[model samples]
Target: MTSIFDADGKQVPCTVIEAGPCVVTQVKTLEKDGYTAVQLAYDEKKEKKTTAALAGHFKKAGTTPKRRLVEFRYFEEDKQQGETLTVELFNEGDFIDVVGTSKGKGFQGVVKRHNFSGVGGQTHGQHNRLRAPGSLGASSFPSRVFKGMRMAGRTGGDRVKIQNLRVVKVYPEQNVLVVSGSVPGAKGSYVIIEK
Candidate 1:
């Protein structure tokens, strides 16, 4: 994230993104695929690293291999296979949504994950039960732990969508987008921006 100067010389925090010069690799139609969507390929990848089938797929689109491919269902603009799309699709002050994976926090405890207050009082000779999950299940009744329990396991690295972020700036020449506030994922991770 970085700060930018507004017209009033006020500094505004924003996230800079390389929007894209994405290529339309495939176009799915209602008749053929039972849906309408365009598969856009962004970033570059080596032909040797890509599978033969995928390489042929990129070849059919008249473009080199791409690192990421995403399909945008019901994209407002009409695009064809092998067409190039740039950041020009967005303009300053445009409201958009960004979808990306959040940073992984690995395995976390219930205190940090579920915000459970650890057995608060230390008066009754409590040992390390401070950060414990407290209880798992009832001893007899059901005889088992229930499903969908929010225990400490894996966290983060989930798909996150931040909506209604204003487009602060658009650099078509550089294919970059400066949006208000922060975005998901670690640095250099790919994100999908939608109108």
Candidate 2:
């Protein structure tokens, strides 16, 4: 994330994103595929590493194999097959939602995972029960721990959606987009921006 100076000399926090030179690999219509959508391909990949079926698909599109292919249902862009999309699709002040996988924090405890209060005071000769999760469940009533219990486990590395972020700037020459505030994923991870 970085800060940019707006026209009024106000500093705005924003996240820089490489907003695609995506190719329209396929266009699906209602009569043919039972829906209207466009499959866009991004990031180049070696042909030798691509599967035979995918190679044929890329050949049909008259483009090289790509690393990512995402389908946007009911896209209203009026784009045709084998066309390219860039940062020009968005403008400053446009609101969008960003979707990406968050950074992985690995295994975590209840105190860090669920904002649990560490077993209160340490007066009654308690040695190391400060961060314990107190109880599992009712002992005699249910006889088992309840489902969906908030306990210590994995943290982060989840698909996170950050909504309604304004487009602060667009550098179409460099295929970069600067959106207001921070976004999910690591520095080089790919993210989807939806209007």
Candidate 3:
């Protein structure tokens, strides 16, 4: 993440994303695959690290092994196999949606996960009950706990889609895109950008 100065001389927080130099690995047709989608591959992977089956798949596309492969449906443009896609596909001021896995915050309590104000002031025998999830449910009324109760559990590490992030800048030569505001996922994680 970085900050950029806008035309109004205001500092804007932004995330730098390597948009792509993605290769069209496969083109699925409605007749052949029962669906229409374009499979794009990005980030080069070593030949030894790639499986034999995947190696054959890349061979068919006339490209080397790639680390990430994503299929985008309803692509309006007609792209053939082995065609390269660059950051030029997006322009500055355009809005795009970025999808990626959020950073994992394992085993978080309700105070952090659900934003529960833990037990309020420590008074009236409230010893060490600050961050506790106070009342779960009635003891004998419903008998058992209801489903989808907000409580302490695993958090983050989920597929997240951040939509309508304005494109602040585009570096087509380096295949980089700077978008306003923060994006999900850790550094170097792959994100699928959709227009």
All candidates: TM-score = 0.95, 0.96, 0.96
TM-score head-to-head 2 vs 3, winner = 3
How high is the lDDT of residue 181 in model 1? 96
By TM-score, rank the candidates, best first.
3, 2, 1
In model 1, the runs with Cα more than 4 Å from the true position are none
Error of 2 at 149 (Å): 0.4
Cα miss at 137, model 2 (Å)?
A: 2.2
- Which sections of candidate 3 miss by over 4 Å? none
* Best model number under lDDT: 3
Put down candidate 2 lDDT per residue, 26-77, tens digits, no spaces. Answer: 9999999999999999999998899999999998988999999998986866
Query: Which has the better lDDT: candidate 1, or candidate 2?
Result: 1
Residue 143: error of model 1 in Å? 1.4
Best by TM-score: 3
Model 1 misses residue 59 by how many Å?
Answer: 0.9
Per-residue lDDT over 1-195 for candidate 1, one digit per residue giving the tens place of the 0 to 100 score: 999999999999999999889999999999999999999999999878999999999999999999999999989978989999999999899999999999999999998888889888878778878888888878898888899987888889999999999999999999999999999999999899989
Candidate 3 clashing pairs?
none
Q: Which ten residues in a row have the lowest lDDT in candidate 1?
A: 119-128
